[model samples]
Target: MLSLPRSRSLLAAAAIVATVATAGSLTYSLGLGLTPCELCWYQRILMYPLVAVLAYAYYTADTGIYRLVLPFCVGGAALAAYQSYLQVVAGGTCTFGGCAAVYIRPVTIPNQSLIAFCLIGLCTLGLAVRTRRDRT
Candidate 1:
């Protein structure tokens, strides 16, 4: 198997997640004709860049990129969490508009928010592990 080094692998994972997330959101809006609300747009803004950031970091094998990516991840996570909260407590009723899912009801939550949660986990892992060594 062609395997990347640890740091690159982490970046690759994050990149994959962000890519999938961006594609899914785009599909929801463009293919299914589902519109994204203001909060969803905010989360999208945070997510789309992660795809580029992680991909470039992985390609360059930039060990320092994980920390740089943390802010976006954390922001996405917060938005996802708040979105989830709104779904549960407030019934996803946005002041600007409302949010909806593509699927019928196997799951009652928004899939994009779930992706954000997963992205949050991947980013946390990226930051928690020491993908590089300190120069003495």
Candidate 2:
């Protein structure tokens, strides 16, 4: 059975991932001189808060934070996935920053964002499932 501490550990890991992702995004924009597109900004809006929310969850051992985090995850993931489709598959374009621009080589910013959101979302989901399973 998954223990609370283990579940909380997952949240902590999620927090760490969020922190790194947020930092990476900032580095791209503020440090590397890469401007974000509209979609990127939306992903950032959803992602930036997870650092705080997941950190709080880790500190308080508040497993319920998943309720708040998952929605953001879903939204961010959806946007990232769509943007990725635009950049890689559908060949869509954005007025700002060029949605198809591949800054990281092989993966676009939206793809990177998608990966981060998915990781955090999986952690949050794991925390939720393990907590529930333990209760039963």
Best candidate, lDDT-wise?
2
Among these predicted structures, which one has the highest TM-score? 2
lDDT of 1 by residue, 3-97 (tens): 24765666777788788888878977798777887878888888888888878877887766767677777777787677766676765454434
Q: lDDT tens string, model 2, 16-135? A: 999999999999889988888888999999999999999988888888888999999999999998888777655645445684475587677888899999999999999888878887
TM-score of each: 0.80, 0.91
* Root-mean-square deviation (CA) per prediction: 3.7, 1.8
Task: Kindly give the number of clashing pairs for every candidate.
Answer: 0, 0
lDDT score at residue 104, model 2, on the 0-100 scale:
84
Report RMSD for candidate 2.
1.8
lDDT of each: 0.68, 0.87
